[model samples]
Target: MAHVTFGGKPVTLLGNEVKVGDKAPNFTVLDNALNEKTLDDFKGVRIIASVPSLDTGVCDAETRRFNEEAARLDGVSVLTVSVDLPFAQKRWCGAAGLENAITLSDHRDLSFGKAYGVVIEGLRLLARAVFVVDSNNNVTYVEYVKEVTEHPNYEAALEAAKRAK
Candidate 1:
């Protein structure tokens, strides 16, 4: 597992760490409507972003940026996963005016977080990371942000999504 920090303090991440060229793992998460959704539910090129919480500054900015990029990236689907409840996620999206990025809640179980190796042990939140999976479900790019409070490499993830499409 890769070393990560939350608020400058070392934190342990749980689950199998993903890598480039590896097949994307399938995990269940709740949609804004509280509907159960899985990896297979999203098709085509995907930019899966895992954040500690959508309420935080970094996570908010990251998701907003991806939501904006999603409009420009043809055939790419951007999914944001967090531990926030589905209702809260829905309210946040509405208030933020985010239309493109689909926010999924992993609170019911750390299904998405653990499957992607972004679960922050003891925090019940996901570590900041982004994964770009191709149409074939092969991971083409992966970025585990070292600091939980920082934004990810948006350009790299966007570029990867473009390539995937």
Candidate 2:
């Protein structure tokens, strides 16, 4: 179990924490079109960013930053997973003009949240976390933000992706 705080209040996570050397767990999340997308679907380096909701200020900023990063990175897929509905995700992406970072809806089953160990048990939201996976589906970086509202280390994650073996 992982401990995280939201609004300065304690929150417990439900799954085991993933490490840099661990095999990345496969999870199924819905794309904006309601198509099921799994970890295996993506090839090459991937940055899997988890957030509570896209509507929140912190989540918004984080996703937007990743979107910008995604635009500049080559052979890398940036996926922002949230608990919002598919329609809401599509709207948010369109409104935010996120062309590179894919906003994935994990509302159907929260599979991504649980598998990634970002599930906020009390709020039914995912904790802020960043994971970098290589072409072979091995975790190269894992960051479980201590606070739900805090920003992850984008530079570190990007570096890990670039250094992925």
Candidate 3:
């Protein structure tokens, strides 16, 4: 369980909290075209960024930042995940001019949130978090942002991705 706060109020998380050294769990998410994507689909270093919803301001900015960083991270795959529908994710990506990072949807079943322990129990949203996966499928770093409405540590997450790569 993750102790998280949404809008300053403590909220419950409904899944197991993973940490560094744990094998990254394999879960399915929908891509922009509604295709199923799993951890196995992306090879090499992986940065899995979780957000509550992409429609929000914080999430939009965070994802765009990651998209900008992704271009610089050659050979690394960056995934921005949210509970928003795939259609909405596609629209957001297009509107934001995001091309480097992939936007995935966990709205179907919240599989990614549950597998990554980011599921917000009450709101049915995902808590902000970031996970770095090495080529060997091992989790090298994990950050569960304490505040849901705030931005995550972008520098730290990028550093971990670089190290893992």
- Per-prediction TM-score: 0.97, 0.95, 0.96
Please write out the lDDT profile of model 2 over residues 73-149, one tens digit for every residue.
Answer: 78888899989998999899888887445889888898998888888887888999999999999999999998889
The parts of candidate 1 lying over 4 Å away from their true place are none
| Model 3: number of backbone collisions | 0
Model 1 over residues 74-144: C-alpha lDDT tens digits? 88989999999999999999889884469999999999988989999998989999999999999999999
What is each predicted model's overall lDDT from 0 to 1?
Answer: 0.92, 0.88, 0.89
At residue 111, candidate 3 shows an lDDT of 89
TM-score for candidate 2, please give it: 0.95
Name the 10 consecutive residues with the lowest summed lDDT in model 1: 92-101
List RMSD in Å for every model shown. Answer: 0.8, 1.1, 1.0
Cα-based lDDT at residue 60, candidate 2: 96
lDDT of model number 2: 0.88
Query: Model 3 segments beyond 4 Å from truth?
Result: none
